[model samples]
Target chain A: MTSPAITVDRLTKRFGAVTAVDDLSFTVAPGRVTGFLGPNGSGKTTTLRMLLGLMQPTSGQAIVGERAYRDIRRPAQLVGAALEASSFHPGRTGLGHLRTLAPQVGVKDARCHEVLELVGLSGAKKRRVGGYSMGMRQRLGLATALLGDPSIIILDEPANGLDPQGIAWLRGLLRALAADGRTVLVSSHVLAEVQQSVDDVVVIGGGRLIHASTLLEFEELASRDVVVRTTDYQAVETLVRERGWSFDAQLDHHVVHDVAAAEIGAALFAAGLEVHQLADHGADLEAVFLRLTESSDAPTTQFTGSASAAPAAPPAPAAPPVDGTVAPPPPPAPPTTGGVA
Target chain B: MIAALVAEYRKFFSTRLWWILAIVMVAYLAFIAGVFGFSLTVDTGADAQASNFLSPKEIAQSIYALTSPIGYVFPLIIGSLAVTSEFRHKTVTGSLLVEPRRSMLVVAKLVSSIPMGLAYGVLATVTVVAAGAPVLELVGDGAFLGDGDVIETLVLSVVVMALWTMMGVAFGTVLTNQVAAIVVVLAFTQLIEPIARVALGAFDATSEVSKYLPGAAADALLGSSFFSSFGGEGGGTDLLPQWGGAIVMVTYILVLAVVGRLTTFRRDIG
Candidate 1:
């Protein structure tokens, strides 16, 4: 990859009375796909425009590698971008459009054909873009960005109009590009597709960053919890209350968090209560994303991106090992950076 | 800036718009030349106002009028459409993305207009030769073809047409709205400016400043026009000399281009 990272530091953009992006900071690390996720009108497009130098930021800057975007010589070659699907003239063919931009980055004519082939638009190279479907226009946008063989690719809603098969193709293409050690940042409002396509995610809402962390870490935070069953649930609840641990008391079992299952079991057995079942509960990314974004108006809602436990804060400290007894519970899963607020 | 220039050329030529407009322009110029030639060829009565004493000079001067009305407007459209179409089509987004520097892109667009003007100039020149020469011959103005003054008039028209095209580019850049720019250009050059010239000639007060108007200055550079005779003598007499008129046309381009560049920075193309 030509650049090691793209750092958007303290970026803010305001249009008259409305603030589009507000003091947002994030790093798109090289050799991985970082999904830029936000609800509609959350300033995702505005932030990308600033990164591409298409708009002036109200404050701060976006830097690719070592230099600011404007300072980079041959930016088209070093950092490829498709800011919008309909940015090309309709009368021009897909090939014609790419050919027009190919020279700006010193790309040869034949390479324009090569990019057309790469994006699967070789057959429609001579056809006017007005005749192409939205899916085809997206492909053409990709081809134009790829014409320079740029090491950094920034795509905005690349999968908006793609068919199921096309999305799968894009999934593979993005993986391949990232695997080639290039920095890839793709933005999308469609959270499901991003969850599948990206290795890392930067979630924003209401013009502020909600979270920035590895996808695996995000999913782990969303899913980390336990369910326990006991003959005397009253006794277990009594112990949980005494220890000030977190748990949801259900009709049969208790959904517990912030304390390990073994600790719950130890506390229960110490009270002479018999433990029948204990299991971890799993929550998907969709549930976590919904809970975080939907709580925009209701600050009282418990589920929040900012309220998420930080990675450095241990949810439960491990208890000392007992002699010739059940081992002390392993610490609750280590919190990775990000979540709620 | 050079890369942006290349990209602009590619943008114009890569589409069917340039070639399509060019073909139509060529046909229109040919038709105009044919009509003008045919008119000179067959007029049973040469002059109705005066006795039948139409000179070769009058006919030659009549041909020069086509240089302003027919020639200036077409090249102006070419320049205006090339810049304005980008806004209409929302293709300005891509142009800015590649270059990023607004001034560089604006300057390149203005520079590209020169070649467009040159192309139209050559076509109009060829039309004058193919159609005007033979007709002028039939009218016993064969000497008009070889006349240094006539040749200089044609050359000046070509140069002036290029300047007008640059003005069209400036207008398009400043107004980004395609229909608005076209309307403003047509009204100012054809309707407003010409009508104002007529009003100036009628009244004694505004006649001096009317000669400085863009269309009048362009006419002044052409040296002779049917309007010079039809509109009366004082209108032509008060107009700037050929060189001064050319300067006025260039000033219009500079003013509009600077305005466009300033506003472009503030425009957030979403």
Candidate 2:
């Protein structure tokens, strides 16, 4: 159990009458790319700002390494953060912007150029930031964060405004950073945006911790629903009910929950039900993320065995059922879950 | 501290505003000085009337010290924009990320403004001299650049510019909004303070207080100004002695800086 690189313990921040971050707590382990996942306006940015000491927390602690971010003597060399893409001065050239930060970060001008090239901004290094496209700005931001070559890197929405190819490039860069044993925490409002790069996830919604676990564990949370198109909807519904599987009945199809397509097909065949079409509709992680975040009433749960560190349960009464069939109550409208290839 | 200062200097120089403002300051001071040099030296057949009030040497001294009365606003604006521009463009976020100690950041901004103010001061002084010297030598008493009082006034003009620049930084720290700071600075320096000083000085009771106003104190610090000499005899207001003016300016800067640190500077940056 190596010491966590970042520890957020019961951190809370309130902006006057509104609480931006509730008593949220999570940790990112070293040597992995952890996705700080949340929907927009869910206190993700607030939490990250608190972690970086840019904003003071109302209560609790956001600790990095052995001390608070401000307490660190040379924080830039230890923790590199690019919290937003718009923080750059529009009139400054990309290299000039990094050069301004270089002396303060205790990095040389040569290191600034290195990070520029690392982020593939060498060609545009001399261009003013105002003229750079949004994607280019994000890359320059990544370049700024990498200037100090810190062991810990935190970026908020690094994929925003990026083309697919650029996002792919970012994904590779994040993975390579993690492979170098750096604790990389990249945040996004969408799960699929960071799905392939993240090894662990710390999810928050409504400013409260919703789930925290390895990517595999989070992926498993996506309820696999089997949609069976059958000639007799009534019989298919009856078969699903007899099997004790929850399902939503559509006009000509029955979307079965918690049962695999293979098992449902076998059950229907044994019953001599004419199944015109039986397909597995695997819910992508993004849909699961939307479900969890969209339903703010979803119970706050931690799956990393550190639930004891989390504050008392939120007001939500229904805990995820022990069977893990459905984490939250089914949405008001059944989600048309599709596989994310 | 060194890194913070270096960062601040870099931030100041990396923008176009500094040079643009410097150019404007040069042009502005040169124009004002030229006007004063011409108006004072030009024999309008009212020479008898003007000489009875101010000596040729005094008129020459007034032109040299014109840097404070007319050109101080540039350093103030430059100083202020140093802090306010960060807030305007949201670059303060990056600044704080590099140096999280907010007080240190503010102090760096204050210290960094000195060189900038001095540069503007030198430029303003040079412009005034260039524009005023030829006219004064040709028409009025010789360009009294070598006079003890004129040299002191010239040097103090530069110092006064630096001080005003620091004041601008403090003012910007308090306001934090770039437009509001600039508007307040322009209004107070160009309109509000001057008018208020004249109005306040019309009364015997308020005349002493008027001398301590920022503009008055700056004039007193320089030891001479066209406005101060214009109303020297009949004008009831008397600016504080040079030392008194220095104290007043320093007090204003310190108080503003402290107040800014306690209020806006301490607030969490979003």
The 0-to-1 C-alpha lDDT of every candidate, in the order given, reads: 0.75, 0.82
Q: For residues A5-27, write the lDDT of model 2, one tens digit per residue.
A: 99999899999888778888788
lDDT of 1 by residue, A1-341 (tens): 44578999889999998878877888998989999987788789999988888788999899987777767777878888887788878899888888788767778899989988999999999999999999999899888778778889999999999999899989999999998888899999887776777999887765667667888877765745678898888878888889897789999999887466677667777888788887765545776676555543233333333333343211212322223313333344532122243
Candidate 2 structure quality by residue, lDDT tens digits, B1-270: 898888888888787877888788888888898988888888788544555667888888888888988887888888888888889888888888878888898899889888878888888898999999998999887898888888888899899999999999998899999999989999998998877777778888888888888989998888874555665442535889889999999999989998999999888888
State the lDDT of candidate 1 residue by residue for B37-149, as single tens digits. 55654554743321133467666655654666566767778788878888888888777767777787778888988887877776676666666667767764563766787
Q: Which regions of candidate 1 are displaced past 4 Å? A: A223-283, A297-306, A311-339, B30-54, B232-237
After aligning candidate 1 to the native by TM-score, how far in Å is the CA of A248 from where it should be? Answer: 14
TM-score of 2: 0.89
DockQ of candidate 1 is 0.55
Q: Give per-model CA RMSD.
A: 8.2, 5.4
TM-score of chain B of each: 0.87, 0.96
lDDT of 1 at B200: 81
